[model samples]
Target: MSDEVIPETTGLRYFDEWLIKKFLFSHIEKRIAEQSIKKYGASPIYLSERSQSISSLSEICKRRGILTGLGDLDFLQNCSLTQQHGARSGFVVLGQTFDKNLGEALQHHAQLIESGSIQFGSPDTEQQIAKFVEGIISPFKDESSRLKVCEDQALDFLSTAWDLCRSLIRQAPGYEPKN
Candidate 1:
């Protein structure tokens, strides 16, 4: 008899197990790479260009009598930025933009929480994380506090994921963290 291992479930793909294991093993590395790029500055030129293009589009839209809301303007600007600089540059620019947005959102949520405008635990996990950072940063009453809180959160998230992966690799057979 052949010694080949076959999946017990018929509907699953042939390599589903390998794929799942691979994803779990590499997820931490992916997070680290993302955090590192954000922290160490991967491509500032791309971001600068993206921001400039967005501003230009907003100006053009304004001059053309287009009644674009801020969200629409922002979306169009991002599209233009991405188109001009290619997908990779666009990805980095958008990633940083998202990070900034999260920080702002957190601050806003924190304000709502402080003012009793919103109930605690009502919002999703992302909203909660943002609110938490906002609260921690609020006490300092300076721009640096917000920056510090964001940086701390980013690092903490990355480190925690990495440590978890290490633990999993130690406990599971055929599981290895990617370099």
Candidate 2:
């Protein structure tokens, strides 16, 4: 809500950056790329070339001390999904916080996966992530099952996310925020 971090762990919690990166972001990106290539004739060659170019450029910058690659923390700080981008030149960087109830649900899901009760990317996990996104944009109604994000908040979040994605697209091997 406010820019301040929630003092109580039960109030709001940031998702684990590593988990978000590995399980959420990376998976989503790959899925999108695959779908795009299949349905829209997106060029894998372009993606490969771009990735290679970025890697090479990043290495050079790292050696020159002009670049320090973005880490999970950097994403948490700089591309926090919690805030609106507004007219900001850079991505809204803050800790992406969500309701604690959702956090608990995700933890339970993780435990289920660990015990092999559910498989990652299964329909179960897909539904879980869908609900997770719903929870992100909206407040939990009746144990976090209902999507209730206000229009303004939803717009803000989408715009902010778009900006963050753009920034990420422009990011190199070692991305240093200009701001």
Candidate 3:
């Protein structure tokens, strides 16, 4: 137990990010202690591999009996985790980077839906994301209730757009011609 200090803003290594996604059970202190384990790297991973073990990356995401996607699971598992778990999992401030929030959240939700394409996999992974993210951030219900919250939002936007289109058709000057 060296009295050394590890900062929180540091990005997670590859292996730590993977365990948190696959197991969804890693605590920051847990990884540090596991590093000391002799004879093996990490469970399902050996400590010798350190954080970024490409060989140890799982091709699938197994969560609560659900599996997602078949290709390399590296970026999805390793990148967004620190974003999801953040400082509690480590002094990890950034894991993966995206251009914006709504897009990033939507992309995550989409991938989740993609993952559920297999049998016994969840079909409403997107429905769970809002409550899932909110659970960590605010006073939304502790669990997700239904799927239409997302659908309703999309419908609302479309409805508004349709109304605007109709109004413009009636209001625009009809005699104008383009050269």
Candidate 4:
């Protein structure tokens, strides 16, 4: 289902922009690293086999499950993982190209992502994000309570980040935007 195409809407358009920005940042980072190595005659950095295997470019995301499904397991003599465990066993990798506050919030949820406890569009995910915003906005407030984040403020934050990232990418030395 990852290959399935979803039509663009207001929400999806934003999603697409976010994804493209992530890919662009990674591409530019790699290019810059390569240039630095060439200019300084420094040794190239090598990635581990596992890290190299997980290429973001290879993962085509669609409107599908946040976790990957386990393939046929009838061949196993004794399977220890139950259906529930199998359902949430997959991991979704996220790239960091935004503010530290966002990165810290994501870091807090990294465990949940790895554990398959949080799904896309889940209330838990929203709650986490809200909590993160609350922490930044109202550090003195009680952590036990949930703070309602203004929708407009959230959207504005994202828009500003998107604009800033685009501006920085354009200013990147020798960076050329594709036609």
Question: What is the C-alpha lDDT profile of model 4 across 26-85, one tens digit per residue?
Answer: 334444556868998763554332222122223333576232211111111012122212
Where is model 1 more than 4 Å wrong at Cα?
1-52, 55-72, 75-141, 168-179
The digit string of per-residue lDDT tens for model 1 on 1-179 reads 01122224335443234322322233333344457688995632232322333232222243665533345333433433323233323132231235443333222222212221334666476676676677676733433554576688789999999999888878898776679
- Per-residue CA lDDT of model 2 for 1-179, tens digit only, reads 11132232342255444323333333334445668899988934333322222232112142655533334333433443332222233322233336342333223222111111335767589777766666556532332221233455678999999999988877867776677
- Off-target runs (Cα >4 Å) in candidate 3 are 1-6, 9-146, 175-179
Clashing pairs in 4: none
For candidate 3, write residues 46-111 as lDDT tens digits: 323222232233223335644343223445443553344432232222234343432242244222
Candidate 1: global Cα-lDDT? 0.41
TM-score of each: 0.24, 0.18, 0.25, 0.23
- Give the deviation of candidate 2 from the true structure as CA RMSD: 20.2
What lDDT is obtained when candidate 3 is compared to the true structure?
Answer: 0.41
The model with the greatest lDDT is 1
lDDT of 3 at 13: 56
Candidate 2: where are CA atoms >4 Å away?
Answer: 1-66, 69-79, 82-179
- lDDT, candidates in the order shown: 0.41, 0.40, 0.41, 0.40
Native-structure RMSD, model 1: 24.2
